[model samples]
Target: MIHSINNLLYFRQKNPGIRGSGISVNDPVLLPVLSELENLKTSLENYLSDKVEKLKIEISKGQANFPSILHVSILPRNQKVSNGIYVVMCFDILGRGILVGCAESITNPKGLNTVIRKQRGIKLNIDVDGLRPTTKYNNVFENPREFYFGSIDEKQLLDHISLSLDIALYNLGLAKKDDLTIAEKADTGANDQAFDPQNLADARTKIARQITARRGQKSFRDQLLRAYEYKCAVTGCDVVSTLEACHIMPYKGDQTNHIQNGLLLRSDIHILFDLGFLTINYKNKTVILNKEITSSYYGQFKAKKIFLPKKPSDHPHLDALKFHNEHEFKQG
Candidate 1:
């Protein structure tokens, strides 16, 4: 039963694709004991160093190469210090052919919050680094509070650390077996529930705000990527990596992350569009270059209507576009 639960956790964290499947006899058996092996390895390395050294020597003498294994041990309910007990196993893939083991207890909200905070922070960090940045690490420290709460105390910290180590081992594939009986049962109930589009939309709104707060204008770029389906709305340039999401309204003026306020365009066109050198007229759905722009440079682009996937009613939020025309555009 313990092994089955371990496998379930592993499947949920690593192989999300297999999460809904009910446990079967054919399921892997080694998942639960894997963490235990890692824990035993760590204990031997620390308190029984001499024994570990002797074991390594013996293993090395064998003609076949010995693979490292790890064991982790979870405290039984009688000895558990928190609401949830966890253990981890780690394999030494490089040398020594040994495994490491560790365990921890997590009970309070603070402990759970810490895990959530770290995952959120790491996800945002990855997203920002993968995109563009104007200032040196500007987004990195913008909102530390958004990731971690102030209520995390030392006790919770210790609990979170242990749970995180177990999670890390699970991620590293050092567990014995998985058990997701609870999740499987829950998923069946969820499948029978009615869908709520409004809830999904609300979730998207929240996600957009979080993304915008962390990534700034790059968030708008992602919006454009989705709005235009990764193609340039004006020139039909499908070079996704080179495409830019241009805000019809200056980002400073309209802080909203509405998809309707953005457009996907080539990098050069994005610069022109933002500089008041160009404007898209909603009345006629045409791209209008300012007269001041020399004909030799922008003549071909003037008065040319953009090719957007959706109808005009679906994009360039009217209020936002009006603000840009009144404040940012260079009048003819």
Candidate 2:
């Protein structure tokens, strides 16, 4: 199948504009099956258009699910396949089947080996909520499985693609100018949440992964917001929507969710803290600003004391603060 695609692309490269008996070179992206699926392509495009519109509407109601993903691609050895795209097949939060395919070009063998931590936003981990036994399609495909969107059921696949133009449009106002050529049957093999939650003994492992990955931080953030009265510690910006709960020690495998380890900050302030432009001296309990921050509003907040919770025990951990100051802060 791959070899055939290579041949077709090679012919098109040399003999351009000759959309002879085979698939149109314009519609180079396909499922590696039948060439006569203009009807299917139109249906998929229409489906995507409707879905994006629906998502745009739902955003106002706060019911939108963002389809951010970690995407990776590889250049096959054939050199003829110009565009490589990974087709991610899985289920959504509702346990209903879903698939997503997006194109990313890898020019050479070295590019294939590079792991793209491109989209840092948390993906809806399919193992936890996606492939559960809510519908009749439960046992049909493997749990936490992925394949090309069209491979499962050709008739129904177009309706279920998760990649929406709305996502790119919303964030970047990005639209593909050309018919995006895609490579199929390529997956990044990244299971951010690894759970084969079939055995009784694996309960600990499953719970541990959940706690380390997502659920713990979510709960911790909520606790911090409530504990600190949902105000930014430095500037007293109380806009709930613009607030973010930031960790004193970096969010990683070793971090703890103790309320003492967090601060409720405005989203921009949180970013500044992460990027080392802002920091707090735990012992002196004073906010410090890097020299790069020339704004009067930010300069006024410099050397100011941060608001602490009423309970002394809920104060920021000195060790976490030390780690941040020593490792994260731009002291120069």
Candidates' RMSD to native: 19.6, 18.7
lDDT of 1: 0.43
Clashing residue pairs, candidate 2? none
Q: How many pairs of residues collide in each model? A: 27, 0
Q: Judge candidate 2 at residue 71 and give its lDDT.
A: 15
State residue 155's C-alpha deviation in candidate 1, in Å. 43
Ten consecutive residues with minimal summed lDDT in candidate 2?
Answer: 57-66
Over the stretch 1-332, how does candidate 2's per-residue lDDT look in tens digits?
Answer: 22322333333244332113233323434333224223333334454463333232110001122111111111122322223322223233222224233222233211111122212353432321211122212122211233222235442233223322211221122323222211122243324546553432353344334323443555676678888887888888876656776888876653566787888888888998999989999788789888889465688888999988888888899988888998999975
Which residue ranges in model 2 land beyond 4 Å of their true spot?
1-212, 294-296
Superposed model 1: Cα runs more than 4 Å off? 1-219, 253-255, 311-313
Superposition TM-score, candidate 1 onto the true structure: 0.36
- Taken over the whole model, the C-alpha lDDT of each candidate is 0.43, 0.46
The digit string of per-residue lDDT tens for model 1 on 204-308 reads 454344323334455556656776777887777876655766777656433654578787888888887888877777666677778888475667777777766
Span of ten consecutive residues with least summed lDDT in model 1? 57-66
